[model samples]
Target chain A: MTHIIFDLLHILDEAGIDQPVAGNVISERLGISRTAVWKYVNLLREVGYVIDASAKTGYTLRKRTWLLLPYEVKRYLKTKVIGQEMHHFEQVPSTNALARQMMHEVGDEVQPGTVLIAEQQTGGLGRMNRVWMSPEGGIWATIVVMPKLHVDQIFLITMAASISLARAIRHEFELSALIQWPNDVFIGDKKVAGTTLELAADEDIIKYCLVGIGVDVNVSVEKVMPNLSRLVTSLSDELGHDVDRAQLFSVFLKEFERRYQMMLKGESEPLFREWRSLSRTLHRRVRVRTIRESFEGEALDVDERGALIIHKDNGEIERVIAGDCYLI
Target chain B: MTHIIFDLLHILDEAGIDQPVAGNVISERLGISRTAVWKYVNLLREVGYVIDASAKTGYTLRKRTWLLLPYEVKRYLKTKVIGQEMHHFEQVPSTNALARQMMHEVGDEVQPGTVLIAEQQTGGLGRMNRVWMSPEGGIWATIVVMPKLHVDQIFLITMAASISLARAIRHEFELSALIQWPNDVFIGDKKVAGTTLELAADEDIIKYCLVGIGVDVNVSVEKVMPNLSRLVTSLSDELGHDVDRAQLFSVFLKEFERRYQMMLKGESEPLFREWRSLSRTLHRRVRVRTIRESFEGEALDVDERGALIIHKDNGEIERVIAGDCYLI
Candidate 1:
């Protein structure tokens, strides 16, 4: 029944938006009774799909839900492998945590490019296990991929994800989206999204990598996370209205899949160049705080491995592989 | 009751091996009745403690069991952190998997340096999820540690673990235990032990690292793994008898804790130097097979991050980060 309903939706989508098809036409096309067609359309309506129905015209699709349901996202998804398999949840402790549990339980059976998404994460995490405010109307997702990359090169996965997010946000909202050092995306000066990558490896070979991303699409950032309000902004806050999350998610997955495939083929130069071009931290004076020490330096460039190369005040060069960067 | 049994065993230990202690003496030390003392001693004997009892001369400690029970191992453990808390099981799927599960369940409550060990793993795994034949006599254990290091530098944890295993095997058996490329330990030409490090990182900072070390102590390698008979070995096969596994495990934890502490304090140079001296793969003609390509080169040296620097036949120096290395 669910398949029939999704198939009905697909047919409606192919008929083009707001185009009405007769009830007899849909029943004949689907090889089902007219009563079944009406029932499936009602089912879609219950899930927030707007279908105009009347005695004169059978049905016309008006709007689809922005709730990030698998069927809704799949309808607009344009990717080869990424997001092909998705587990959508109304709520989870953390999508990354759930993804890790799934990988551990299933081991090799968990396919690459499997996405675990939650409408709300009760305990969402940012870099270094920091608390991330994830409320309803935000995209909290983790993507599991067994990339054909070395352990040292796993940082490129985060870079690619950040680039994908920035590009998607720019494409969707027509806002100038930029990336901060490491893997945080920005709009002008306020943080909009963040990407984190977790890796499991055997020796130097990567067993699996989890790319976790959180984007405040429709969230009221200041109201949800008052402590971090000054530094963060949501898409809805910037645009003065909510955005279609399902569409943004589909675009991000397509961009991510394209860049990820390139990295797998050892063609990472173009992706790295893109990351550099969209980076807001490069060529800026920044304070790099690592676990060991903190220092201020000119952010020169990011190497191929994604390490930040900095020119220090004492005329010495420092390469920081992992740290927190703040624009000075 | 378990605590009473362990306490009684400790009292017998203090009386010295083969030195008999009167029943009244134990009851006085434990503030228990003579019947209670006898019951506790029986409990200890049931769990593999060797105790000699006589009506005339109370009880005497004969020998401690070589089983790696927490009580048995803790009696000799010298480290302050590593192995201070241990979970011992007769059989498990894999110690590493269990450690990961424990961490996921309890999060920060799962302390660093905690050890999970199993007598046998029904579904043991090696590098790249290869089948690891973990019989009753092997030491299959995983130590969970939250190290203060960058994700890229996590290879050093494996290096430290390899060095510790090699040192422990050398100290215990007087064998020429050397480490192969990455983290496999060898005695002569056959593999005697192996170490695998799995890291969970938030971006560049390591959240926790599971250092899984498997040592074939008293196992019969040929009988257990016929295909790998020529490539692997056990301590008993070389020494002509079974080794005290508790002693070996205690030594390894001590060595590991020392190196781990040094790493936490930003003192990895000495540890890296030690790894260099004990490496069997360095300065040898070897074949490095990565996911992308395979090439043969002279293994010149290892960098601070444990990447293999190879001098290729084409007069170019290539750095191999993660791969399967075979000596030519």
Candidate 2:
């Protein structure tokens, strides 16, 4: 029964949204009876798929919910490792928290490219334990990776994720997307997406890494982040249309996989150069606040370890490894 | 009753090992009666304290168990944060495992300098998930630190720990203890201790880090590590006398606290200089084996991020961040 339901969804998905696939055609292709196809199509509709059906024209997929359902994502995902196995939730405490629990429970047995996604999070956290707004209509995901990299090289994982989000948004919508220093993606002068990282490692090897990404896709920025509305925007608000989140996430996985493979091979010069080219913070006057102190400087360059080199006004050149950077 | 018991133990501990204090003396110091003092002394004896008692003289603490009991370690410990709150077990799966679990369960509620220790570990793990030999008479400990450092600077925690062990051993026994890159302590061509690190971090900041140190204190190398007898040694084996583990641990905590403070203040040049001076692997012909490949090189120096710089025989200089190095 499950297989038939999945098969029916696959057929309708291949037919494309708003395009009808005749009932007889789906039955013939899946080697199932027409009655079985009808039953499965009803099941799919019950699970939030909007399908327009008629006796003569068959079924047309009207909409797939914004949720990153595994079947919806895997159908378009092209990466070999990423998204091979996925877990989806309508609401969770946090994808990264659950991912960390899973990593601890099933150490060494967890698949590297497994993905965990949630439509909403009640206890989401940003850097320094700040509460992140994770309402519905946003892409909140954690990708588990077992990279053969040193612990110090872990910032590269965040770099790859941020770059992937930027590239995916740019390629899909032809929008001008830029990367901020460290790991935030911006559209124009406002933030659209951000990335976080968690790692499990010993002295010599990184056992696993969790790269968490939060993109404000179809979120109502004014309603969700009213205090920071001027500093944040959503994709739908920018483009005046809701995006297909599953497709955008699939593009991100592919982009991430390509760069991840390069990093594992010790070929990160190209990635660094790409990050610099797509960077919006470099050579800009920015205020960097670390745990100890805050200072403003011209963002000169990023070193190999992803540390931002800042030339302060006091004629001192400082390397800020981890901090919050704001455009002045 | 618990306070009196604690007071009785404190009196005996202050009187020095095997030095008897009069019953009246303990009773007066604790503001209790002699009968109450005798009862508390009996309670301490039941919990693994070997006490010698006489009606004429008083109670004498003959022995404190080899286990790193909280009272035993805290009595002599004088650190601002490190080991201020300790959890000790007679046997556990692994101190680092329990520490990680506690860190997860408590999150921000956990104290930064909490220490977890075990007399023996049933499933101890070494670097790269190797089986760590955790016999009964070894120092298996994990220190929880919430340093205000970037994720890239985490290796400094391991450096501080390894240096602490080397310094403690040298200061106590006058033996020439040296650190092998990246985090192993050796004495005269044999390994005596090693360190492992685990971290929880986001893209811009580290939430918490667990530094695990395993020292062969009183372990019988031939019995526990028969396959690695020539490569491993214990402190007692080197000193030809059973070392006082609680005293040694207190010294180590002091050593660690000092260096940790220095690292937090960004005064790591002194630490790097100290590590180089006490290093047994630098300036020697070594075999470097990374996950990708292996090659012969001369150990030149370590970079600020703790990466080993090697001059390969092919006239190529390679910076190895995480790998095994063998002196050839």
Candidate 3:
């Protein structure tokens, strides 16, 4: 139902861009009454969307603001499952948290490709409960997927997400963004975006995977934590202009689905190749700290199942399943 | 509050074992009023507990039915977390399903060591959504735990559960139960019990793990699926008497936590050694089928991370992470 109005709004937008378009023409083409057209305009206005509706002229979109609204996302959303049914929240504690809650409520009824988007998260969560500064302009979203894979291959979901995020940044802004070992996305030594892949599964079956991604889009360094300012960078700060978050988000879902599908189809060479090519942590002196132990080593490569293979200084090769990776 | 009433019920039980005990005598010892004791007795009767009250003899517990009530579990529960908060459902779709739902609702506030038990689950689940035959006398329960471990070490949780279950069966019935690789508990090659470990976690953190265990206690083979009659065994059928469900459950939790704490403290060698010794899959020709592929190999020892090390016929060592092992 929202998608129908979203499509009508786009038609009005195209007509508005040229000149004032007639009400009857839109009504005739859309096969809806003129009163129906006026109803939608009022609905848009109530949601803070400005629609220029005159007696002679049909409804014209005066502006399409950068809101992570469902209608706005549906305009750019082009995927079978990922974001096919989008739930947009203006302000949430964390999109990842909400997605997990929704998954529980709906149970198996929840679709695989559903995406949850939030404009700002008061308590946005990064990996290991780290506070992600999700201000008004940041892209805080979580995409849910049900991958058919073994438990060992679950890490590949994170790997695929990392590759997709890096690719999305490169495609949208033409920036040379690289992946920093497990999940952080960076551009030329400064971090731009990061992803946290959360999964729920039985021993032999994966229930669902929530790919929570937070990208610093239009926020400044000062808007984030003071200490993080030295290490973090946003798309707007690097690009010199506020980027379209809706476009960036939609592009990311497409890239993620592509990589995710390949993984489900039992292809690792491409994902590994892409991840290895974009990863800066590989072949660098690194410190991997886990809950059990921490060690300093030179990261050789990520294995097929996404385990980071590292060669310790004293000559022991270690395979880290998951940990905090620091490039020293 | 429930625990206090549970304590009162135990007192009435002990006094009633020999003869009918007076309510005033019970109240004097417990330091509660006669009215307070009567209120507890009435509450117990409302839940289908039978208590015989004569004006001369006072209150006597006539019968404690085979019900997995909150008070029944709380009476025996002792631990820091695992069974500290118990949710007893008479007929849930699945204990594991309810446990996961509770975890979602309470979020992280749902403490570790919380246990969910059901008298009968209409749709009791095994691993990979298999329908577990949870009859009236069977034990259908799920224990929620928040283990701090690497993703690779996640398998140890299942291993710990297997050992705990085997030990509990041995302690309760003096039966020789063995551990099946991945998760089935068997006695003399006939399966007596099984466990399904469901986990919701991020790459770096575990949200919660629901260890769903189903034990055929008082249930007979005829009550289970007819096809499984030849391969399944129960504690009662072997001992010729109904084993106490609450006793078996409480014992299992204590054993589980002891092994769980050992794993958390990085003492996994003992668990691995125990699992290897009891494993029926080890040193046997087994066909392990994972999501992507399947292979026939000699099942060697399970590695520290709980990967089944299989020596393939053609001379390659295959590590089966999460799979179905069929002895061939």
Candidate 4:
């Protein structure tokens, strides 16, 4: 029903601004009720779409708001559902937190490709209970993914997301972007974006996963953490101009869709290759802190499960499934 | 403060059951006021510990309710907090679902050892979204664990839990119990208990995990799934009599504490040894269904991460991190 209305609106939008087509013409072209066309226009207005209407002067597209409405997103989206049904919030504690709540409320009914977007996050959380700074003008969003992968391969989702972000940033501004191990998008040794993934699953299978992404789109370094300010950089800061958030988001969605499909198909070698190509942690001298002990080594490669294979100074290799990785 | 009260109560309990000790005697022995001793006895009563009190008779230990009250559990608990502060529900969807909700409501303020227990579950969940039969007289509990281990090693916790349950049953009932790979606890090929673990973590560090355990303690197989009537058995059915839930819970707690401590200290080798010794899945041809694909292989061994390492017929070894393992 919604799709039909959207199709009508798209047809009307393509009819050009100066040309006002009659109801008879539209009905003859699309075989829908004239009243139905009028109802859809009113519905679009109720949802913040300014469509000019009249008896003689048919519908005219006025201002296009950058609100992440489902209709607006779907117009540009090419993927299945990731980021298709967006929950836009002006202010939220955290997109991840809201996504988690929504996951429970919706349960299995959660639409695949549902995106939770927040303009600002007051209590944005990072890994290990650390606070993620999500000020205004930043892309603070979480994407729900129902990937058909084993729990071990779950890390590939995050890897794909990181690669997607890196690809999007590179494509938009032609900047030299690199990916940090796990899920941080870096630009010339400084972090520009980060992601935290939370999976809802039992011992045997992953039910769902929420990939929370925070990109420093237009935010300045002073807005982020003081300690991280030196290491983190923003797109606007890098390019000396503000990037279009809507455009970046659409690009990210498209890239994420391609990568996610590959991941779901168990075609991770290509994604892993792309990730490795963009990763700065690999071949870099790094120190990893596990719970029991800490080890310093050179990162050799990442395995299929996304475990870091580190070559120690003693000619031994360690496969680190989980640990805090620090570039020394 | 609660600890001091329980200590005094323990002393009074050990004094005599028939002859009640006078408040003056307790005050003198514990070096506190008679009024304080009276207050402590009232507190114990509030926590479901039935103490018969009289003017001249003083206080006599009659019977203690096996309720998992915070004070009662804290008094006897040896671990940090896993089951010390239990939030119990008579009927809930699932202990794990409740735990996840509580984790969000309380956020990081949730103590590590907090546990959620349900008497009867309306939507008791098992691995792969299977319906877990949690009728009355069954143990439906979720224990919160904040282990400083790698995300991969998190599986060892489940392994340890199964080992703990098997050992508890063996020690308490002198019955031969075994573990089916991944989650199920069995007795002589008949499944008796099962567990589900949910992890909330970042790529590097795991924030917390909820281990939801369901044991057919005193419930008959008839109370469970009709299909499992011939295959499944309960503790009561195995023992030919009803089992005291409180005693069984205590035994499980003690055994869990031992294994949990061992796991925390990086002593998973013994846990794996015990799991191997008590496992029914080993040396069997099994079909593993992961989300991506299905494969058949001989169950070789459970590695350190508690992943079932299967040696396929094609001479390739597959480390299944998460999947439904079915014996063929």
Name the Cα RMSD for model 4: 33.8
Weakest lDDT window of 10 consecutive positions for candidate 3 chain A: A38-47
Candidate 4 residue lDDT tens string, A124-182: 98766678888877899999888756787888998989999999999988998888787
lDDT per residue for candidate 2 within A241-326, as digits (tens), equals 88998899999999999999989998789899899999999999999999999999899999988999999989899999989998
Model 1 misplaced regions, further than 4 Å: A1-328, B32-36
TM-score of chain B of each: 0.93, 0.91, 0.89, 0.79
Worst 10-residue lDDT window for candidate 4 chain B reads: B65-74
Question: For model 3, what TM-score does chain A reach?
Answer: 0.90
State which docking tier applies to candidate 4: incorrect
Clashing pairs in 1: A204-B322
User: What TM-score goes with each of the models?
Assistant: 0.49, 0.48, 0.48, 0.43
Q: Ten residues in a row with the worst lDDT in model 3 chain B?
A: B101-110
DockQ of each: 0.01, 0.01, 0.01, 0.01
Q: Clashing residue pairs, candidate 3?
A: A81-A113, B81-B113, B82-B113
Per-residue lDDT of B152-180 in model 4, one digit per residue for the tens? 78888888788888888898899889899
Error of 1 at A128 (Å): 72
lDDT of 1 at A102: 60
Interface RMSD of each: 27.8, 29.2, 25.5, 27.9
Model 4 spans > 4 angstroms off? A1-328, B1-60, B70-76, B223-227, B292-296, B313-316
